[model samples]
Target: MQIFEAIIGHVEKRCEAKGKRLTTQRKLVLRALIDANQALSAYELVDYCKQYFGETIQAMSVYRILEFLEEVHLVHKLNMSNKYIVCSHIVEGHEQGIPQFLICSKCNKISEKIVAPETITGLQSHARQEGFTVVSPQLEINCVCDKCGQ
Candidate 1:
C-alpha cells in the first residue's frame, strides 16, 4: 500500500512537471490498472472501478483518460491484446525504454522487458529491406510463463 501511494505521488509529480493535471478520474483509472497488475480493456477498467472502488465511470471517459495517460508515458496499450497496462518503468522508478511484452498464452500474465536499442534498429533495418516502414517498435510476444509452462 505504501508503495502504491509512492507510485501515485511520483505520477503526480511527473504530471505537474509536464504542466498537466492528474485529475481524480485519471487517478481512479490509473489506480484500477495498477491494482489489477495486468492488461485490461477500457470496459474492464470501467467495471473494475465500479466493482472495487464503487465509482461509476463510463467507458468513453476511461478511454479518454487512457489516451491522456498513454500520451504522458504513464501507461501503455498492448495493441496485440487490445488492453492497457501501467508503465512498469513508472511504477519501478526506472527510465523508460523500448518495451517488449511477454504475454502468457495460458495464464494471461504479462511481463514487461526493456530491450536494447540495437534490437529495434535491427528490426527497422529488416523492415526497410522488405520495403516496409516500421512504426511503433513495441513488441508483444506470446508465450507461456514459467508457472504456466510447468
Candidate 2:
C-alpha cells in the first residue's frame, strides 16, 4: 500500500504543479488503475471500482478521469489494447528519456521502459523523410511476454 500512497502523492504534487484539481472521484479512479496488476479498460475499471471501492462508476466518468490523468502525465492510454496504465515515472518522482511500453499480445500485460534517445531520434528522422510528423513520442510494441512465451 505504501507504493500506492507514494504514487498518489506524486500525482497530487503534479496536479498541484499544473494547477489542476484531483477530485475525489478522479482519485478513486486513479487508485483503481494503480492497484491493478495489469492494464484495464474503462469498463473493467468500472467493475473494479465497484468491487473494490463500492463505488459504481460509469464508463464515461472513468474515461473522463483517465483523460484528466493522461493530461497530467499521471497515466498512459495504450492505444493497441484500449487499456490504461499509470505512468511509471510517477513512482520515481521524475521522468527519464522517451517512454516505451512493451505489451504482451496474448495477456495484454504491459511493462514500461525508457528507450535510448538516439533510437527515437532515428525514428523521428525516418518519419520526417516520409513527411509524417511525430506527434507523441510514446511507443507501444506488442509481443508475447516471457511468462506467456513459456
- Of the candidates shown, which would achieve the greatest TM-score relative to the real structure? 1
Q: Name the regions of candidate 1 deviating beyond 4 angstroms.
A: 92-95
The per-model lDDT (C-alpha) reads: 0.91, 0.86
Q: Best-fitting candidate, measured by lDDT? A: 1
Candidate 1 overall lDDT versus native: 0.91
lDDT of 1 at 130: 98
Error of 2 at 48 (Å): 1.1
The estimated TM-scores of all candidates read 0.95, 0.88
- Alpha carbon RMSD to native, model 2: 1.8
Tell me the spans in candidate 2 whose CA falls farther than 4 Å from its real position: none
